[model samples]
Target chain A: MKNLARYIITRLLLTIPMVFILLSIVFVVLRVMPGDPVSSMLGGHAPERVIEQKKEELGLNRPLSIQYLDYLWQICRLDLGESMVFKQRVTKAIAEKLPATIELTIFGILITLFLGVFLGAYAADRRRTVQDYVIRLYGIVVYCIPVYWMGLMLQLIFGIWLDILPISGRTSPRVFASTFEKTGLYIIDTILVRDFSALGDVLIHLVLPAFTLGLVLSGIFVRLTRANMLDVLRADYIIAAEARGIRHKKIVYKHALKNAFIPILTMMGLQIALLMAGAVLTETTFSWPGMGRLLLERIYLRDYPTIQGVIIMIALIVAMASLVVDIIYAIVDPRVRY
Target chain B: MATILEIEDLSVHFPIHIGTVRAVEDVSLNLEEGEVMGLVGESGCGKTTLGFSILRLLRPPGRIVKGRILYHGQDIVQMSEKEILSLRGRKIAMIFQDPLTSLNPLFRIDQQFIETLLTHEKGLHKRAAFTRAGNMLESLGISPERLLEYPHQMSGGMRQRIMIGMGLILSPDLLIADEPTTSLDVIVEAQFLDLLNDLRKQFNLTIILITHNLGNVAQLADRITVMYGGTIAEVGEANAIFDNPLHPYTQGLLSSIPNIKLDKPKLKTMPGSPPDLVNPPSGCVFHPRCPYAKDICKVQKPETFSKDGRLVSCWLYG
Candidate 1:
């Protein structure tokens, strides 16, 4: 237990420099680009004097060093300045959009865990047979597909072609007005208010997008888990368990799957980082009002403050997710703490 | 004594890409009730495969092509999967080579033991099962408190003793141990053998001890079966095999055992490697390595020649 505390403390301290490095990169990369928010907002039609006055007001007329120091100071204070596009606080804009992206990733990952592990364990149990071959081929094929293309195809089929599910947006405007906004997530909000109709609408809208993201992510998990489970199933302990005449199901699920999932948990953390970055393509395609779509609009409007806020937020999330995975791994296998 | 295990013409094969790797072929042995039968052989001689075959635990592409593992009058090789499962752990239990790898690393010793006991005997509550498991371990000289610890937390000898305790929890009719002492030091090995001797007498257990060490066999075996190239080279009393080895392979193995009393500069090694199971030699699998190989030894497989309860498969004896 003392070892775990020390391990966690060391990791937490280490992330400080990592987050600083990421912040420096985000600040420099945004400034390196040749664009100004004032001109982009005015679209090159404004007078030079008016632009100069606007730049002065926004504190962009200051030297680069002063700007950078000031930016760092504001970041330390959790003040990300204001978004030029939304004309609101950058932190507030992100806080609103953050929940939607998180919700999607959560649902997508849940689906991935269930389907991937199930299929992988099944394939291993039926190894060397036709069913095993077929499942493996399917895993490889899906793994080769690009997520954006898959997401678009899902939209085309489930949205435009079949027209059973919504093509875009989080929910109908009626539910937006009627549902209580306790959690910012409409589904959760609806449940909190016991509003079934709004929940149905939100869930229907979530299906195509979540299904598309989940299916793409599941390919990786299927192959990883199948390989790991195969290795675990052949382990001497599993054979010993079989010799003890324990039921085959108990051996697979209890012994083999438990051992196999350690690596999977670590991989899931890495995939969470990927999912945060990948959500830009997914959220934009679905017209979901998430941080990724906000990022796109802010980029077009040269809203550097919002972009910086979003990027820093993402990097921090990735780092924290990895930290959580390490903790989980230590807990699962006590040898790791030592 | 009546026979506890009767292996008749047992041949276990592995269907590799090239062809069948005949890991264990044309082997026959009989284990009398309450006797310790030591199966001695070098690595890849199919001793472990033969042991696994008794419990029907051979995974593909390794399979029993032809065999009769008769317990009493019932052929276990022909028994249904469910019937075999019932027999395993309850009637015939086995201890593996590496105790570290043979227990689930994720679970505690108590959990593993309780699960094994409850698996064969259902409707048994977890607490009662744990008590029985603890008693089993305590009987094997391991403390009951150690049951809650993980396999990694224990020393190698402790884990091995726990495994032995687990194998005898239900008082099995027969116990098959495959190189149980290979991973232990010489001192630990001797202690384990002593424990096994005491346990056997206490439980009235019949045992099949599979190993390459002649010393281990000399310590505990009532009889011995020598295997080479995946087939039986000789089968006889421990005293007879040690004193007057019949087959050339047995002679070579006995000669290879190093003697500390003599100032022998080099330990003897058999001239050639064991034959490849996939494409073994035309006649005797040992003919290529046997100094006694002749025209008949290279052309025709020899039949077993028996005399006074001893058997040897060699043309010289035939």
Candidate 2:
């Protein structure tokens, strides 16, 4: 317990500087870009008084160093400022949308983990056989198909053709009133109160979009698992395990699969970040109303606060994903620990 | 005496795109209960191939065309994969040649040993598994604390000892020690051999000691088989093979062993390389390098003949 505490503290301390460096780079790069945030907000034909007022309001009239210090101060104070388009606090907007994006990413990742490792190992265990070829084909086919194309195809077939699931939006309007009254994240409060009907509604709404997102990411996991599991199976220790009269399934799962997880685990955090990047396409198509689709909308209106806010959030997420991955890697493989 | 493992006419051949390469050909040997048999040959002489074939680990390309690997009178080639796996650690086990490669370096010794134990003994919880693993390590002359150390943390000698201990932990009826101590230093090698000698007696283990070191073969193996060009050139008691080797290849191999005797002449190497498996010599594979080669020797292959209770495949014996 003490060791774990110390380890977490070390990780947290290390992450502070890393996050600062990332934020500094993002701030500098955005500043050097060929546009004035003030002018971009106001139309070019805006009166000079309006422009001056906008510049003063945004605190853009200060020196570069003072602006950076001011940005750092806002960040330290947790005052992310207000969104240009929504006219709401950036943090409030993100907090409202963050849950939806997280829910999608988590469901997608869980599906990928369960199916990818299972199929990869199964294929490796039966190398050069028909099953191996079939799984390899599946991996290749899914990997080659872009997520956007696949998401549309799924919506067409499953939503339009079958009508078994919701075509767009996060939840059904019928149940949205009675079932989930609190947080818009219908899945959680439903499960928290053991409301099966509400839970089913949430799940019914979740499957198509989550499955679409998961199906895309699972290809990478399957290939990684197949490659890593095959390598581990060839290791002498696995042969030794088999020689010891261990059942074949145990050898594949416990011996081969666990050893294969180091590589898989390293990719998992990256996959979370990738899923967020991918969610934009998914949300736009599905009309899920997550930050991804919202960000896209802000991009069109040239909403500086919303655009910069979303980008900063995305950067923070990517950085945090990597930090979490490194920490987990150290935990799982003690050899990697400092 | 009951034979623990017997391989008859076991041949492993690899069919290439262009030609078929024979790796182990027409080789036969037997290991009695508690007997240590040494298989001595140069690299690529099919020693390890023979070991893997017994385990039925030969994947594609290298097919066992005609062979009968009879472990206690049951043909292993006919056994299903599950049956073979059942026999692997319970009845037969193999210690790989390179200790570094044998162990998965990513795992700690305790994790690997415990996993090995749990694989054989079902439902053995982690505590019991750890206890057994630690005890096995201690029995192999390793300190129990070394169980926590990773494979990299241990010395070559320690790793080799751990490998032997892994093979012995199951107390299999037959243990195939394939060049068990080949990668260690001379002193470590001798210590490792001695450790194996002690463990074999303790567990009544039937061992097949595979190596190219004639000196170690002489000290360790109860019986010896001299392999050349993927076939057994000579098979006999170690003393008999060392003293009265009948085949020319065996004679050449013995003559090449350097003796440190003060008055004796220095050793000499055999002439020419081993016969290529892809295109082996038609008649006697060793005829090109044989000092007593004749017109018949180049045209006619040698036949196995029994002499003094040992098998020798040489025209001179014929």
Candidate 3:
């Protein structure tokens, strides 16, 4: 337990430098990009003097080193500065939009795990059969399809032709207007307010985007899970378990799957970054009111603070997620020491 | 003593893309109750496959193609999945060659032992199962407290002892040990054999000890069965087989054992590697390497002949 705590602390400390590097990169990339907030905001038709005045007011006219240090200092104090596009603090904008993205991501991960793990294990258990081949093909084909393309295809099918689900937006306007927002996450707020119909509405709106993001990424998991399951199934202990007369289900799920899960868990941590990347495309495609959509709009409007802030938040989350995975790995696998 | 196991015309084959690898072929053997049978063979000679087949635990691609494994008059080959599940830990158990790999690393020692006990004894409480496992471990000279530790925490010898304890906890009628001490050091191997012998007597276990080590067989086996190229070469009482190995293959195996008593010992190795199961030699499997190979040995497979109250499969026996 003590070792785990120390490990977590060390892991967390290590992320600081990683975040710093990412922040520096974001800072450099945003600065070196061709667009200026003042010109982009004014549609590039404003007089030079007016643009210069606006740039001065925004502190962009300062020296590069000074601006960089100032940006870092502001971030150190937990201030992400005001978004040129939203006319609000970048931190507040992110906090508002983050919960929706998080909700979508949570659902996406759940779906990914459900589809990937079970299908993968099924394929492994029934290896060399028709089902295994089908699943293997599914894993490969799904991963090959681009996330945005899949989202559009799903939208076309489920939204237009089927017309069963809403293709765009998070919730129906009626539910959005009536439900009192408490947590910023529409699903939870609906549940907390005891609004079942509103909850249904929110979920109905969520299915297309979340599924789009989840299905595309689940392919990696399926392949990973199947490969790991095959390896674990061949382990001597699995044979030993069979020899002990343990039921086939227990051996497959408990013994083989448990061992296979360590590597899968590690992969899952890495997948968070991929999931976040996928969320950006899914959110923009669906016009869902989430961080990804917000980041896209801000980038178009040359909202430097908002873009840098969103990327920094994502990098931190990815780092923290991997750390959590390492801790869980150590807990689950006895051989893993600090 | 009653016949505890009867394997009649057993043939285990692994069919791959190229061809079927005949791992065990038409080998007939029976075990008397409370007897230790040493199954000796070179690597890839089907000794381990035979051991696994008794429990009907051969994985995919490797299967019992033609055979009847009768455990106390019940055909294991025909047993349903549920029936076999019940028969496995309750009636027959197995210990593998590498103890480290045989035990699940994630589970504590007690969990592995208790799982076996609980699997066979359905109504047994978890606490009672733990107590039983701890007692079993104590008998094997392992501390009961160490049951909480993972398999990796223990040394190879200790882990092997735990495996033995688990195999016996259900008091199975037959125990198949496949190269159980192959992974242990020399000193540990000696200690393990002694422990196994004492346990065999105490529990009256009927074990099929599979190994290439003739020395281990010499220590504990009452009856010895020598296998070569997926076929049984010879079977007889340990003392008789040791004193006068009838089959040429047996003679070569016995001579290959280094005699330390000689002033300058010459270690004799068999001329060629064990035959590939995928493309085994046609006639007598051992004839290619047999010192006294003849034209008949190349064309016709030898038949098992009863001579002096023992079975020898060689043209020479004819």
How do all the candidates rank in terms of TM-score, highest first? 3, 1, 2
Tens-digit lDDT track of model 2 for B11-34: 899999879889998888887888
Q: Which regions of candidate 3 fall more than 4 Å away from where they truly are? A: none
How well is each residue in A1-338 modelled by candidate 1, as lDDT tens digits?
A: 78778887888788778877887887788778888788898878899999999889888899988988998888878788888656699888988898889888788888888888888888988997898898888788877877788888888888789888887888876666344777777778888888888888889888877877788888888989999999999999898888888888989988999999999998998898778766787899889999889988888888888988888888877888888888888878756753
Output the lDDT of residue A135, model 1: 80
What's the CA RMSD for each of the models?
A: 1.5, 3.1, 1.3
DockQ of each: 0.78, 0.49, 0.88
Off by over 4 Å in 1: B263-266
Taking the tens digit of each residue's C-alpha lDDT, what string does model 3 give over B46-151? 9999999988888888999998999999999999999999988788889999998999999998888888888888789999999988899899998899999999
Which scores higher on TM-score, 1 or 3?
A: 3
Interface RMSD of 3: 0.7
Estimate the TM-score of every prediction. Answer: 0.97, 0.90, 0.98
Cα-based lDDT at residue B141, candidate 1:
80
Least accurate 10 contiguous residues by lDDT in model 2 chain B: B258-267
Residues A220-257, model 2: lDDT tens digits: 88899999998998887776666566677987887788
